[model samples]
Target: MSAYYDLYETPSPKGREGKKSLHARVCPIKTYTQDEFIKHVAAFQLLPKNQIAGALTAIIDDLCDLLADGYTVEMGDLGFFSTSLKCLQETDDENDKIRAESVTFQNVHLRVSSKFRKRIKHAMKFERVHSLTRKQKKITSTVEERKKRLVSFLKIDICITRKEYIRLTGLTPYEAMKELNDFISQGVLRRRGAGRSVVYVAGENLKVE
Candidate 1:
């Protein structure tokens, strides 16, 4: 078995005029090394590998410098970069359409400082937002919150099983099964997967959603 292999037993699809089913399955995420990512970026940018690498490194250094000095850097069409919260002046009218008073972190600005303006002659490297800046934590947090809602929805004492959930939710067989597994792990639902699977029936003693 592969080192990352994980196995899950799914519910059966037999019986109940209209019901859902589950099956044994496993899923794995493809891991990408940093070198692999850089190669892809270099190819996409149509630039020599070394030039792309140097450009990326320099941009990161500049962002770090601005952030360290507690000054937000706003690049006209792009967005601003700064610490969590700091006062900033809005010089560009780029956000005039959306009420000029505020800007969001999602947008990016890429104006280089005047000091470095004359130093870089050729192309001056159009600043890019490297993939490293992505905040996956927010996405992960969202997924968890949705899982919590799923658990609360299933916590009723009305004898709900993985099969019934799939049928009611209209979720694909795989999605229903994955949700069930997540709820089971969260201790909001229980299951016994043997020859025939059954979702543990919660009694009145168990809290209902």
Candidate 2:
């Protein structure tokens, strides 16, 4: 009955670096297709379904044409639609020259009118829905589990390669290396060879208990 939203950490703007702050993003439960959308409009208005569909199709066609023709379309309180341009070949060099053909409309944007925003705010009730948020990517294995898996693999082979260890346990390259070095210091895994040719062998502490 009410709108649902979830908190998401906003990305830092370009050229700026700081701790990110959270923002509310709406969670849409279902997506309406063209037919479903038209049916909904027919339910709300006195117009026939066919007439509403035809009018909607014509409005979309003309909106696209007018926007392409370089005119901003104003849809009453809904907002203003305008286009923005981008150069095909971008460069930082001050001497570099760009041609007309190189520049093209990159995107179409809409600025929602305050009247429309105010109306929505007045009519809608928002609820925080935590389940709508996507879980962040991360390594899920515990420190002991990772160490145990590596120790087990080294027991089966003469030496475990860095690449094989990474595949066996989904640790990133940096994490794998850091853990491998830590194991070496703890006498849990012995470092063999060097650089790209490096491999790991069982150490004194690696004895299974």
lDDT score at residue 17, model 2, on the 0-100 scale:
90
Per-candidate TM-scores read: 0.27, 0.54
* Leading candidate by lDDT: 2
Task: Write candidate 1's Cα lDDT for 106-138 as tens digits.
Answer: 333455665456554433322111122223222
How many backbone clashes can be found in candidate 1?
Answer: 8
Q: Kindly list the per-residue Cα lDDT of model 2 for residues 39-87, writing each as its tens digit.
A: 6677656569999889989999999999999999998899999999898
The most accurate candidate by TM-score is 2
Give the least accurate 10-residue stretch of model 1, judged by summed lDDT: 125-134
